[model samples]
Target: MRGIQLSFNKTQKLRLDKALEQLEYFSSKLNSNAIVTVSDTIPVNHEDGVLKGHGTMELEGEVVATLCGVVERVNKLVYVRPFRARYKPEIGDIIVGRVIEVAPKRWRLEINFSQDAVLMLSSMNLPDGIQRRRTAVDELNMRTIFEEYDVICAEVRGFQHDGCLHLQARSQKYGKLERGQLLTISPYLVKRQKQHFHHIDQYGIDLILGCNGFIWVGEHVEVKDDMIEDQTNKSEQQNNKLSGLASHQNQEHNYTPLELRQYICRAANAVRVLSTLGFMITVDKIMDAVEMSTSKNLNIHEMLGAEFYVLVAEREAERRSSSSKKR
Candidate 1:
């Protein structure tokens, strides 16, 4: 869906436009006058010495927007949240990023931010789950932990004094993602929440809703319960490894089932449709779209059809309309 141009027939185009209009109407009712465009001066108490946030800059002694977006002010801090743009990181946000450059003492990731984010080796635990100070040998073996192009999950550790965004992955759940599909959507669609990691029990899959645009749909991985292994368990595990090393390796390489793979693609397609329709993507709505396809017995390939797109747009319009009335 990223580069594909979808063509809609006349009837489909009109229907889609109407549905989008309704959706826009409902959204505009919430903040119709707050929208501003490039170089537009933000309405603020100029005497208060307002601190400008992202998407804004102080030009000629006036706080003017640098992009087209909605204006927000918190106390004396004012910023513009752009409609369609790269992710703006906040501290403690769970994110999925791809390793771009394994730099010295740090692994730089492309988190869809204005600049790439860095995850320092000193900031993360070793593979053995130790928190000791990183040694020279550890720096030499950084690639062994995370090579270029590896998709990983981590949390925001906030910006540094030098203005670099740092990330941390001290938890077992945060590590290299394997045997999964990565999908990118609008970052604003994903609001920060308490839980971004979701396990779909029915499909035996894991869905990570990154605060950034990247999403991961993969086979469910049972999180390792213990970070520090006791001597007894280590001994048992070593004995077990000695008993059947090949078998253990085979188990580790177990392939995903065909049925599960199909479901993953189906779920990914649901996300694609939602993104294309400009709808706010959430786990519940994604599951609903998947369930709709399942109930209708539609094939995975058919989920991207023009008809399905129209249906999703219509469904969202009707849903928003109903919720508005209930309020």
Candidate 2:
């Protein structure tokens, strides 16, 4: 939906017009003062020398917007946040990335940041959840852990003095993500929330809303500490060793169920449509979108059609207008 041109027919054109009109109407009724387009002058009392932030420029003794976005004022500082913006990594932010390189003591990952972030071997706990000094043996088996192009989830552990961003995955929740799809959206659309990891019990899907805009829609897996798991499975492992049944397991055990895969796609499509609509992406909104699709009996690809887009827009418009009235 991004960059690719979509040609709409006459009916679609009319539907989009109606939906957009409602969106604008509700949006204006809520708040319209802080919105500005490119080159629009931002009115500010320059008496105390106000500090202008990103997306603003000084021109002819006036503060002008350099981009189309919403203006945010905090005390004396003001900045505009564009609808489509690059991911800006911050310390402690959860991020999903793809491994690009496996260096001697670290793995370089493309995290949608200004540059690739480094995930040092020492920074992450071993699969056994044991803490010890990493050795040359560990370095040799780095690929056994994560190889190039593998998707991983981690947290920003601050940047080094050299300005390189570093990441860490010390918890059971953060690690390699698999059995799902990864969708990229505008970072500005994703708001940092207290709980980013979500398990949709209804669909058996795990949704990781990474702060870096790399969204993960995958099959849900139970979160458990490896330390506790290994201790509990010690007896099971011994029994399997004696029975010699480990190598005789079914090869199809790794295959994901068809229904679960469809749920993952549904969730991923919800994220895509929200990003295209420039709506604030949230877990609740995503769930609602998926539910709407299900209620309408729409196919996976139909969610991206013009009819669904209009429906989504109308729903969002109504929701916003009602919230505004409440305020």
Candidate 3:
């Protein structure tokens, strides 16, 4: 399912092949001939009046797939869901993106979509956490909020009239992400859910699963309204010539502890390994992989080893087989 460009030893290769073969065997038994690729004509009843949905196109009165995916039918509607595709934004979906450009009043983000998404200055909460009209001065200082290459977390606010995507960060939880690692994975692997932000208090890490396949693994930061209060207080003190009393406190925590950084790396590597194996990336799945490595007493780097890869594959095969039996 995934094409990894790493070399494997003889035993590791055999084990990996066996695990993959088992997974394929189970998949074949379940889906049979239902799966189809692009240009494939999906068989349907003409008398029933089938409605061709996404990933399908009419080709000479035939329902041909425009994408490489499995055919799905719902009453009179039929569509194909592509296996490997770019992230398609949906309203209310939380996503992680990087600012590529600071425009006139918005920041353009690269969210693994066909077109970059726009995060308007007005849509997000200001640094002071105050709600007011965005003045011309605020627009001029937009870069101070989000400069180029700043990783941001926001919610999809639907498309504009011109088909451009718009993002919003109205809440405290949605804004600039810091002290973490950003990972890219296939959007298909990330299943949509009501909750995307997960704070693992035990490990002291926060995991944000962006619907756009951009994952943020980092240290937890509390959402506070005090930033704007400090700004307000500092200005008043400056006007009264009491600047010493309004000294700016170093509130930003920059250094990540060595242990916490190691845990982040382990979790990130676990995600990478699962994605490389084409496994569904859920919180439990990722945590299980991390725990597996810990139980085996493997170092953080060893999680990416050939032997570990085969082991993970074998575990996935067993998991799938067990799930199939349960079904």
Local error of candidate 1 at residue 91 (angstroms): 2.2
Tens-digit lDDT track for model 3 on 1-327?
Answer: 455877898888988999999998998888876788889889998899899999998899888988888888899999997777778788999999999999999999999999999999999988665568999999999987899999999999999997889999988899999888999999988989989999888899999999999999999887755565456764663563344324322235346899999889989999999999998888888888988998999999999888788889999899999999998
**Winner by TM-score between candidate 3 and candidate 1:** 3
lDDT of 1 by residue, 44-91 (tens): 888887899988998887889998999988999999988876687889
Model 2, 215-255: lDDT tens digits are 99999978886666457566775675455444434532668
Ranking by lDDT: 3, 1, 2
Q: What is model 3's C-alpha RMSD? A: 4.2
Candidate 2, residue 47: Cα displacement in angstroms equals: 7.4
Per-residue error for 215 in candidate 1, Å, reads: 1.2
Per-model TM-score, in order, reads 0.83, 0.85, 0.86
Winner by lDDT: 3
Candidates 1 and 2 compared: the better one by TM-score is 2
The order by descending TM-score is 3, 2, 1
